[model samples]
Target: MAAGRSLPCDDEFLCAICLDVLCQPASTPCGHNYCKACITGYWDSRGLAHCPICKEVFAGRPQLQVNTKFRDMLEHFKSMRAAAAADEIPVGPGEVPCDICVGPKLKAQKTCLACLASYCEGHLEPHLRVAGLRKHKLSEPVSNLEDRVCGRHDKMLELFCEPDQVCICFMCLKDDHVAHQAVPLEQAHREKTAELRAATSGLKMMEKVKSSSVKDIKGSMQRSKVESDSDVSSINAFFSALAASLKCRQAELIQAIQEKQEAAEAEAAGRVAVLEQEVAGLRRRRSKMEQLLQTKDHLRLLRRWPSLQMPAHSEDLFAPEPERLSDNGPQFYAGIVRDAVARMEKAVNNEMELLFHEVRLSGSCEALKHATAAEDPIEDLIFRSMPKPEEHLRMIQRQHAVDVRMSKCDFSPGFVVSEDGTRLSFLEDVRFCLPEVPNGESQPPVVLATEGYSSGRFYYEVQVRGLDNFWVGVVNPAVSKKGRWILASYMNSWGCFDASHLKKLSLKRKPEKVGVFVDCDTREVCFYDVDAKTLIYSIAGCRFNGESLVDFFTRLMTSDDSNHRPKLYPVFSIFGSHSSSELVITPVSPGP
Candidate 1:
């Protein structure tokens, strides 16, 4: 072994205190070798001189002399090991470097718990070969080796205190944590690994659930696209049919005018032919009269004039009175055209409203317009304002009309109600810092008309022209405005927008004006589409059932009104967050 065989086996070229290939190796008086600074530091830090391994106390501090021969051997060993494993990768970011490597650190291969150091394959050779080091624990390379050491005891934390739920050194178990249940670090690691695996299993389950939800969402999207495409095609066909009808009607009108012109020309031609015949007769008579005048016979001229007769079917000539005929010609057709146009406009506007109603299913009015962009449409706003009388609504308006006015003090903040209570509008820029109303802290602004109905049938109309997320319902005056929000058409029913026991409804037309009629005797409420003359909805057998729940809450939030008669009042709700449209309580009038 070249006279250095004992060096590797006895670890003579290593430091006992620093536990690495010795730098400036020094010999102690006790026949041990250590790095010179390591020995001096050990003594200076302790203020005593002693062997760390053997614990042989000295009477006084001993001088540490450099072991030149041992240090030369260590340098030789280090250089030889470095040259042997020179092909290994150098340590890079995120990789633990060998603690004992002299120059650029090589990637660490193993860590030693006994030595508290990481080693590359070059420096790890002695640990593998030495019998004394074989018993030391070896692990995968890890950075921050000091974290595994106990802070207070300065020993390797090799155990876990179960009661304390912390990593502890063996000395800690013997001291402060002596009575605590303890487990070997490997056992605790195994248990923690099991827990991690369980958590991973739960995460995998959640991942699968999320994946399924994503798949469902994708399917819904596909179905919506299909439906949208179908609707677009249907709307295209409808407009094409409509345009065809208009074209056909145009042809009919033109043809009628052409026929009328042709007949009038024929009538004038007949009258002109008759007048020409009469002129030829008068010319012949004049020639005859001239000859008679030459014969000096006045009696003959008079006789000839008497024989001259008026043309047949001629109008009166003496006074020449103009015919008093009612000329039902082009003017008559003009009235017809005007009437046809009015009917066409009404029907077309109604169909256009149907498109907005389709938004609930399509989820977007803008998307629908884009989807049906193939038709160069009439401007959308023109159709939005069209309205005609509805039969049921008009009847209700005439027979059951009741005056409704909003209460200024009763309405929630962030809203402005008209002095007459006919108009309701929201504040656009600010959330109110005003006084609290009865509906304080309840989201959105609410307004209930001052008029309440407890008996008899009554109807009122609301002009919901530009409103969104608006609710026009009858609330029981007996309960707080919060309760008996009996009905609403809340923004296509998105997100908890529903009446109690509400079911989905499909409207063919979005009503611009709505009429709500209540019959207390029958216990029934009916909503009317004012323009379409259609019953939007009707809820029968309504029991306010308001009193049952109001008394259960704390007195601060409760109002004892269980025994009061449930008188329903008109309620207008505007979710100030989204709605900006104004509502109008319109005056109802009878249909002519």
Candidate 2:
């Protein structure tokens, strides 16, 4: 029955025994007391024989007490605390001790309800005891007293009317409401009090809903804390596994680098040692040859008499006969020495070749090692599996157009002509005309003739006034078939032209101020739908009058009125041959 250090005794109150609050109260048993449920529950499952409170041996069940006296004492203490709190009035609760009287003041007496005015009790005697005050009923001061103003005049309540249902000053009831219907303030107050009760009931309902929502929010916050802790643990576990994997990979990479470095160093050292040994052998051979040359016989042979004659001096007679010398004498010795030196030279050359071969092999090994160490394995694998350079190049060549031909024109016109022979030209001052036809394929046919102007591009200029006759089309020979004519022209006056065959130009009304014309006649006057590639309008069997090319253009481009005077012939033609006849087409602006 002894209490565990970590576990609170079952006999003890779950509520703090020292504070004696009843929250989750429990009990303990002894001559001394504690919470009843606390002691019973603490020893319920234990098989010990001692009491939890006193640790005394008990052969039988010890009786647990509820300690009602202690609980009664706690309740009394709480009541006393509440009563004490209620005895003192707060300074802000519409009531306070009177400053002048030095005594507690009743909030109800501070202001006279009948007079509808505020005054301290010390100053309120006149309002209560005045000549007609005995019939007045006073009320406790209200914090919202300022809100009870005159409804009609929006002024502070200064008097209460006995007849009208309103609070008002004497002057208001006497003059402003002389002939109006009114009621006494007491009657109005009763009605307003009922309205106030209804409003307060509605407010209570709203407050209850708001309090319930707040409790739900608190519960949700606790759940969110639990979920957050679980998420943190999961994240930690995942990153720990990732860290372990990364550590393993790092160790492997480091080991591989170390092994490669050691192998390369050992190989380099082996090559250096081989070269050193070969050099040392060469030096030894050279030293031995030098020593052989310094022998006495060899020196004597080199210093042999300049001439074959007997010495004149007797001292020179001691010199031995050169013919009686031993077979292995200076000459034979010289031959053997020369043979040995030759053999040593041959051995040195062989050793040098061996050393050079090792050096070359070592250099190749180092280059291979660097390549292996530097290249990423994945990249190397991908590169090795890729298509050959020649094959890749061939594939690209097959898929793309290497050589293609585009349209070229020798000369082109820049105007549009109507079937009525009215030609409109747009002379571009700073702009170049592009064939409006799709891909310039269905452009009007015009005689493109070159002249002294050798520049491949054509330029012209024209001026337009408000909503008058304007030029709007394009012409290029590259888009026109030979002997076929195309024109895009509009006029203010609508008219139909009679021809053997006709086609209309379906050009977009782009509000463009320029047009180009190309001449390549095949006897058919065909008008193209520039953007659509279909024939929009055409005129066939129109005779090509043999007129001067320049005169024809000049007449067509000139304005009909003299006042406008068509400032300049707004058209020019690049004629390939001066002798050919060509038709021109013109475009007009569309209506809004």
Candidate 3:
């Protein structure tokens, strides 16, 4: 009975005497439980020891003892009750709490939309028992119960209004949503859930594709790094060999100098040995002569002079001077070194140029250029996966071509029209003047064809071989051909500029010819690269038929034209300083 506690208990756990939960519970012989105090008081008040539940009598005074096991069970129940009370969650502000609960309201488990009330488990038991309450609709507890019921009719909201996209009550079907497309709420929920699932599936597929692309890019980067490392290693080895050769050449040069010095020293030592021998003879003779002067060896001295005769002392007895080493040898070697270096330099320069050319030829340079030019990271990734420009063009063309003619009217002063009227050129001005109009706005060069189409499909080819900036497309009859700077800028016109500004139709190569196809019935306009047979860009869902023309004329407050149906004229705009550039409306090539 504690607040916020809804634990159920058996009747046996209650004291029969006090009609309350048991305390110090004890059992009688009749197997009925009672509080010890309550049982004892009942027996004493009756003046007899008897079981109150079964009417069993006890002869003499029965020995009363506390039931220890029952006391333990009562203590366990008390602990659990206290724990449950502590675990109870108090209702907070703005939460749907039990309406029937009085004191410290409990959080509601469910709400009955019919009764417009929320109930906690304790108070909700009545809904399960009472037949009337059971008939009420129940749903997860919500804060705004009134929103689930219609304000006008006071009925539960059960249907969905598809036209207005709102939840409607049952009464709405007979009232506001009677003519509207209404369906059961469950059907709408199912359809919306299915759509979400499909979108999720598509997202998952895209994630897989992006993940695979990332992996491929990483793998390519790793391979490129490996190739670069290998190239570095080869370059290092080449330089290392060159250094070793230089060192060997240096050692050879030093050895040649050492051999020359040894040869010169040996010749000088031989000459000096001959000179010393001559001096020895002269000394022997002089010694004998001195002995004779002393008279005791006069006979020996005279005999030695005749026999040896004095050694001839000539002025030619001189050592040969060693020649000064010349710088010629070293200079010759230096020349050889310089020539070797020059040859190596030339070879390296030529090899590097060849390698650079090879890289360019491999299309790596083009790929790198495009990657750098891309504005977005995702766009760059997609661009890398695209096929070659020629291949893409071929796929779009599908061999489609058409005959077209240049317009004569609205020609700017700088242009030259061909004699046949099939070609238009922005040739250098010779002697042309601009026509003065009432409006101050000067017209940029533009032209429109006389023929137009309001129904059926029509195709044409325009040769834009030398032009850099030009426009091509079909325009509404109301387009300002006199002073309009851009064709696509106007609401009734559709044009693609062959310039960087129009990224979708930016051409890598100056298309020699362009094919324009227009389907009036479908309101589709497509441009193709004629030579490459590639589709450039397309504008679909255009409004260019009879109805659109009528609307356009209506807005201008003008009557219908002489033609039964309004027609769209092929238009062109050209602006360039060079007169040589020409825009020729050429006929389609004959089919094979």
Scored by CA lDDT, what does every candidate get?
0.71, 0.42, 0.65
Write the residue-wise lDDT of candidate 1 on 1-592 in tens digits: 1122223543655577877878888877788777889989999999889988788889888877887887778778876665555557689999999998777888889999999999887778888889999888899999998898999999999899888899999899779998999999899999999999999998898677656655665666687789879989998998899799889989998998888788878877777797698779778977876676687676766777665544564344345644533366887888988998897786566445445444423433443344334333563453344343354455567657888898888987778888888988877664422222223444345788898877667888899766545678687755553445334555554221212455456777668888888886556788887777778778776655343333323421655534444678888876533445678999876667
- Say which candidate scores most in TM-score: 1
Better of 1 and 3 by TM-score: 1
Q: What is the C-alpha RMSD of each candidate to the true structure, in Å?
A: 22.4, 33.1, 24.9
lDDT of 3 by residue, 122-224 (tens): 6788788799989987888888777777889887778899999999987888888899998888899999899999999988987776676566666666766
Residue pairs in steric clash, candidate 1?
A: none
Candidate ranking (lDDT, best to worst)? 1, 3, 2
Per-model TM-score, in order, reads 0.43, 0.30, 0.34
The candidate maximizing lDDT is 1
Q: Please give the clash total of every predicted structure, in order.
A: 0, 65, 6
Question: Which residue window of length 10 is worst by lDDT in model 2?
Answer: 452-461
Residue-wise lDDT of candidate 2 within 1-592, one digit each (tens)? 0011123232342243333545323344335454555455555767653555468767777665456666776566556555644643434453533332335543334644555654554345655568777566555555555566656665556555545645674457677667655555566677678989999997787677556545655665566668668977997897799689868975885586567667767876777797688669667756765665667785564554333223366353355633421233346545765797697666556445545444433422232333344344553453243333233222222222111111123223443333343333332432223334322343322322222121111222111212222222222222223222223233322111221223333344422233221121222233333322233344443323323346545655885423211110112221212122232333322211
